[model samples]
Target: MKKIREIESLLGLPSPSNISVWWNMGSLLGFILVLQLVTGFLLSFHYTADLYCTFNSIIHIMRDVPGGWFLRSMHANGASFFFLLMYIHIGRGIYYQSYMMQPRTWMVGVTIFLVSMGTAFLGYVLPWGQMSYWGATVITNLMSAIPYFGTNLVEWVWGGFSVGQPTLNRFYSLHFLLPFVLSVLVMLHLVFLHEKGSTNPLGSLHHVAKIPFHPYFTIKDIVGVVLLSFIMLGIVFFGPNLFTDPENFIEANPMMTPVHIQPEWYFLYAYAILRSIPSKLGGVLALVFAVTYLYFFPVTMRMNVLPMAYSPISQFFFWQFVVVFGLLTWLGACPVEDPYVNIAPYLTVMYFALPILMQVSNSIWYKLIIS
Candidate 1:
């Protein structure tokens, strides 16, 4: 068929040499996306979006539905692991300077990450558990810091003065819809990838050396997927609650807030940022700006111009930044008092400063070598 021939042609196009294990991350992310979609669809069949019934529905699914507990645990734990892999994937891109050459691909990937976060946040509220209710309340209320329109916007988002039935319904609908959008974005991401082709560790262009995607990379991807699935299955079967908040085990109660409110592990870094600042508006703006500013890294940061892997100093800073990010994630889960709160701002500063430091270090290193 013409279609098959065209597909063959696309697959036959060349890619960069020395791609290594880092290249497998994009495919790995794609694999996780598929798993999330399949499990989410199955869970949706048994889930109810109503605030009054949402908690009970989740309980019913866990207790009554055949293999429902497994499905829910897999879906839940999968989210944390998905974020873990994504952070690594993004970090790998930065380390290898993959974003510099294929800016569009990197940009699309960032968009996918943001959209995925939104989808996950919406899904987290569906259980209507203690953390779910208050987490939604705390996060949505952050919008109330937008000067004149803040309170009104917050009310509009909640569909009432507070988080209630309407909030749950809206979140459920959007959560169901977002995965479809993410799939489309992923297709676009691949289109951009194929257009520019992949950037390998050696930073070679596609024209210099390329290979067929199918059979070669396909087999590689399958191996990575299988390995990742095994790890995910172990967690789903054996330690489902390892990463979840125990407070969420209780049903949602608007009257009483948890002693220490926190979000799912993935949101911990941003949550830490939110709690670090004194001003509500400042915290809200900081969160939004933190992510949006990443889009400008390719433009504003001078180090992005460097041959990244060749620069030892830049590589060191890049990995250090990742370690700091992990630390922030852990700190976010801690109580927002004393040492945690006191330490958060310093960590947050380092978190934002890493890229700039890499840029500076890379620039100086380039000059020293040239001079």
Candidate 2:
């Protein structure tokens, strides 16, 4: 009884009544992170990171180990859904102007996203599959666009002139190492969240609007987890290969290239940004910019009011922003030819134009328009 009361003192809060279903994304992300760590550890036991043994080892796991395929599928699909929920969590934060009050929390969140991307990319290469090979080749080559020592840096990364055994070993080591790092970051994220506290759907941080964390949020989070479990289990079982490429099943051949070569779905948007530009250096810079754009949010956030309550013009534009993001995701999956080839540049333009739109909208609201 005493321990329960002590824990309650740590967790209980007067939270906002207006916080809606979207606020559940953070809870979902936490669940997914723990899921990834567990499944990944199990999968790693049978995984081999060598050039010759890696692909066959995966096959061995699938054939030999009981329920190994199920575990592997869960890990792969879990990564995809983690990114999916994270995007929603970030979108929700933007919607409620959580960034304004908790900029440090926002910064840590962005760092986690970037680190998670790195972790995912490293893990993707461990299977020693075709897409894994070429994907690593294509991305690491981007660093070679740097001015003087770029080629040297690339060689160091790959442990040679190319992506081969040493490269695979390094990626395997980091893939195992980074999740532990992320676990720490996740802890820090929670600390910041608990400190600054959560933003309400109404964008109010009012003390009077606060509520206890246990009975209310704990219950809501449980419901969210149950719902997420159903959807993810369906994906892991029925459509295991849905998000993956057929080429990945084949062994990697440096001499051969697929008609269409792309990263996994989560990376496609950035891949699209990279391909949209003509110059190699230009594409690399744009790719870096696209991913790191959110890093500047603290400096760029000159918000006049909560986004939902701001100008209807901006609200309409926000929906347009969502549409543009979706279009970019779709367009990225399309071939690098014809209409998509032409459409990509324009979409990229609109993609980047969004931050500027938010800044301008906030300026207008605070300055001339509202007054």
Candidate 3:
């Protein structure tokens, strides 16, 4: 009875009444995380981590494992949905200055994002396809750009001098394990969010009416889930391979690298940043910094009122950052030569520059509003 009451109290906590559809993303992400866990657990029963068997095992799952294709498709597409919702969730946070208000929550959220990417990268290698093998090789090789310990670190991660059976086994194990870690981090994120409370579309709502989360916000989450489900089901049944790379269909052959090696869509922005730099070590550092820079937002955009809500200048810069992000994603997929190559370095500059610009603009606006 005590536990039940606690659960009720948690769910029934007062949330700002004016919060909008954007606020519902957190609940939707929770749903997708559970869905991915269930589907991945089921898919693991028939999977083999051996390099020679990994590719064929995936085929066997599709052909023989009774509804295995559905499971595989759901798991695969769920990952895409996971990243999509997460990206939107992160973007919503930035637009609302949620990070500035709830610094601890934002920090945990960014760590979750980084860990989720690592988990996804590991999962990407499990299919043992051409892209899978070479993608693993390319990304793992980035660690070798570190100072003296670089080569040893890469070899240790590979379990040998090259990506092979040990690499597959290691990736498979870590991929299976990381989601559970993600689940815990998510719970921690919620704890911090509930502690600090949610940031509404408005800057602050100290005097506003607070509503229970159960019926009001839960309904919005349900609507989001239903809409997301329709899109996911459509892709799973009608176009399972819609987001898959063509190179991944071929079995992994270390001897033959794809003409154009690219990661899944979500990593494209960072990948573009990685490619734009001429130095190997610099590219790796830039890629790490690209995401980690979010950590500095609490310091950069610190202010009492919501930083972005009333500031049109800040809003303009935010949208420009979004455009730069999208352009970089597109450029990440293009062939790494001319026109495209020339455009990426410029976009990379804008990608890092725009956030600082938003901070400056918001700081000025806050001063004017106070005056």
- Specify the highest-lDDT model's number: 3
Q: Which of candidates 1 and 3 reaches a greater TM-score?
A: 3
Task: Give the per-residue lDDT of model 2 (tens digit) for 145-165.
Answer: 999999999999999989999
TM-scores of all models?
0.96, 0.96, 0.98
- Candidate 1: RMSD over Cα atoms? 1.5
TM-score of candidate 3 versus the correct structure, residues matched by position: 0.98
List the pairs of residues colliding in candidate 3. Answer: none
RMSD of each: 1.5, 1.7, 1.1
- When summed lDDT is taken over every stretch of 10 residues in candidate 1, the lowest stretch is 297-306
Candidate 2, superposed: residue stretches over 4 Å from native: 1-6, 366-369
lDDT (tens digit, per residue) of candidate 1 on 1-371? 99999899777867665678878888888888888899999999999887678899999999999999999998898888888888888888778777777788888888998999999999888888899899999889888889899899999999999999988889999999999999999999999888768887876664776677777888888999999989988988888889888888899999998998888888888888877889888888878876666687677655334678778998888888888888888998898778888998888788888888888888888888888
Collision pairs in model 1: 14-210, 14-211, 15-210, 15-211
Q: Which of the two candidates, 2 or 3, achieves a greater TM-score against the reference?
A: 3
Instruction: For model 3, give the 10-residue run with minimal summed lDDT.
Output: 300-309
Native-referenced Cα lDDT, model 2: 0.85
